[model samples]
Target: MAATAIPSYNPSPRVEPLVQYRPLHPTFGAEATADFATITPDLVDEIKRGLAKYGVLVFRKTGLDDARHVEMSHLFGDLDDVAPFVSGLGQKNRLSSDYLFDVGNVNPDGSVMQPGTMRDLLLKCNYHFHADSAFNPRRAGISLLLAHELPPAHLGGETEFADTRSAYEDLSPDRKEEIKDWVVLNSQLQCRRNANTDKDGILDPLLDTDEFDPMKHRFGKHRLIQLHDPSGRTNLYIAAHAHHVEGMPIEEGQRKLKELLDHAGQPQYTFKVQWKDPGDLVVWDNTCVLHRSVPGGYAGKYKRDLRRTTVHDMGPQAWGLNGVGATWRSGLD
Candidate 1:
């Protein structure tokens, strides 16, 4: 009896978590506590799960270098290079890796970008709520943004995100049905125009330029309402990049788009993330959310060096209406 009892020995189970998440908002953003510098397969899987549930994940003080940033981004999906887009602007990528995009107001010489400059004006479009690479043939799925250097505290430069999935759920049944089958044409030029609409004479010089002509560029045609596969919820895909409805008059489509955007961007469905440390990282699913940069007094005074790596959407609707061989073009291409 004793020998038989001794034979059934069991050791205590040991369990360790790869990562943990703290909800930042009631519905959307989360703060992930983990060592992102040393990424593992299990860590990546957990990160993906967090993105699906929260739509945005903020990691503080990850201390990931440019190489590590690109490496970790690859675990999400194929990385999107900014070369094609920046080349058309007649600017060279200051970052060492093509996968790492410069999202801050810093010049190649490590100087602050003065206001009213071409780069500064172009970056103003980021103030509007929009999804990354929405105008590209294959839209962006995940974006990993790291703060390499930040401006002084309380000077602003915070990033804001809108929960489109939750916004869609808030819409009335009739409203949802009205846009259920609608398609929109998304263009980079349209995004710029929308951002500068109120600024008198700001876009005049660039309007007649071939590179800024909406008619000369190809547009990304995508459904206004789409099912976000990861979260298994429908989302409003409208953005500032959306030019007009597929079959409606330009004026009518613009009005409808503005209405939808205004409703979706209400304060109840938005969250703002402040950059506290230089190593702070924020990963967001562009497919289910829209993000914008907040303007602060730090512009032209301090350098905010933010770098981002974008992953191309690999889902069924990744290419939208653009078929295979539809490469990325900034009008010049």
Candidate 2:
């Protein structure tokens, strides 16, 4: 019989530097090194920097409640008041505040929507690719979705993200030259109409064209190629909300939009993220990526609840002479 020697502990040991991010995808997507509770202002600044570099980040096992979710979202930037769109949607049971955007399959009464119904069909509209608040002039920079409730793995409620930045980079020189002068018109009315329209007829009968109003919904016209303010990188900003290229025929513009979307949707530029746990949080750059919810079978059978918070870009010119966040620095160097 041989006796094993026990190792003695040293008075002091070398401490390894903490890893901040782990890469999830080559083009865009990373996982945080620590828990959400340990995320301080400095770490948040680093996360912001990482977000500026990578298009998406996934934080796993963050057991955050509604109030904490809102608190953490504010560290990135000022929260957008999404009350208008969320107010009439549903129950406020899990919502920490009215401003939190509910991105879920659960009904207002904490029940799942039945399959093939109008509400179910409307939820299917999210299957199309789009950036959050793209039609608005005050575009969302980053969007964070926290998984409050998750469905069974077999049910499949994954989210797909396309890196528009990489997609733009992958374009051929000729294609780039052709689209350089193109301008895209993004409108909520156009987006809703496009979603409801199908091969034979409208999928959702409740969709009304008469209710379209510019005053009620946001709309904007932007160049096809968008430059990232922080990184100076060019990204394609086309989305479902984009109606057409200015001055081009409607049919031609739509064809071009579909072509670009198909190109961007390629497997190389797209990442389909599945929720492995209940507390998973996905943070992505809305400015450089288009995302969509995967419509799983029977929303009523599988319950998937999620909360989203958007952070607007805080560029100096963004808070110009009369902006809300800051006052003018007209003569500053």
Candidate 3:
């Protein structure tokens, strides 16, 4: 057989009549500095529903303290400790990474080699554009990224969340059937990039021995392409980690992956966070959202600081709350 041409994912032609969105309330333009007052009843309810529907919600300018940040996150569920894969330091403990997740923030190849070292890593707003936790079965229920410091660049600190619910609904029935039971290998890579940024060197960017077990480093890979078992929702989890689709050919597999990625990141389905000031907190659903920091920004200015709490649904081997350090099921270790 020759090969199948990659499918295009334009929904404009197949969908019903055109629809548009006007803001619910006069769409108050985002403010410069969001006030961090008490979490209102309306805010909580909207956050819950938005997390379920859009998989992400962006809060601009809410100046909350550490205690309140953790307390508010607790209402959602337990939080996970910052894994070695992330860059956490100082008071910001539970985040996936700490300090600034920006480009120059991480050391050469992307791992933070040491504490308090200025490797010129990228700003936190320069997010890498991927799902929060596709590796675990109980993926991160929601991500709370609060901006205390904005990138000095002043333009691209905003985050883009694709409407994953609609993304899943738009999939062709045939494409849906093709990946019914498939899974993908999920791993974290922060090191091993050659000067060219294309050379693949090792399994992960770093050993990740503290957060992830060196033995289970290669063993924890769950599946090749994920189907949301809990919600019967379809979302792609493959990122820099997914190398192949279990039984699919190398070239063929890559083609399908690219098509999915391109379709997922379309601007029409995404919302960007042009950060106005600190005190902004964003909560998002990991299962139904794909996020990325627009690269090519804040290459060397501004120190981005944000705190995050990872929440997972009840699982037999659920990850414990992120406190002094990360503690998980020894089996997973």
Against the true structure, whose lDDT is highest?
1
Candidate 3 global TM-score? 0.63
True lDDT of residue 67, candidate 2: 80
lDDT of 2 by residue, 209-295 (tens): 344422344346667786877667898988887777789997898899999988988899888888888888888888788899987
| TM-score for each candidate, following the candidate numbering | 0.94, 0.83, 0.63
lDDT-superior candidate, 1 or 3: 1
CA error at residue 30 for candidate 3, angstroms: 12
Clashes of 1: 0
Residues 1-333, candidate 3: write the lDDT tens digits. 989999987766564312112221121112122234665544555456544444555565566756677667767766655444343332223333332222223334433334223232213212444665544434466667766666665545556666554555667899778866555444333211111133453433332335433224431243333444444555555443333455678568656765765676666556666656677777766655677666445544444555566676433222212222343322243
Q: Which stretches of candidate 2 lie over 4 Å from their true place?
A: 1-19, 86-94, 116-118, 201-203, 212-218, 316-333
lDDT by residue for model 1 (1-333), tens: 545555666888877677788998889999999976578878988999999999999999998999888988898888899777667666788898989889899998889999887787678889999999888888899999999999997899999999999999999999987889998998988877666656564654755477777767888888889999998999899888888899999889989998998887999999899999988999999999999999999999998999999999989999998886588664554
Residue runs of model 1 more than 4 Å from their true location after superposition: 1-10, 199-202
Local distance difference test, per candidate? 0.88, 0.73, 0.48
- What is the lDDT ranking, best to worst? 1, 2, 3
Best prediction by TM-score: 1
| Candidate 2 similarity to native, TM-score | 0.83
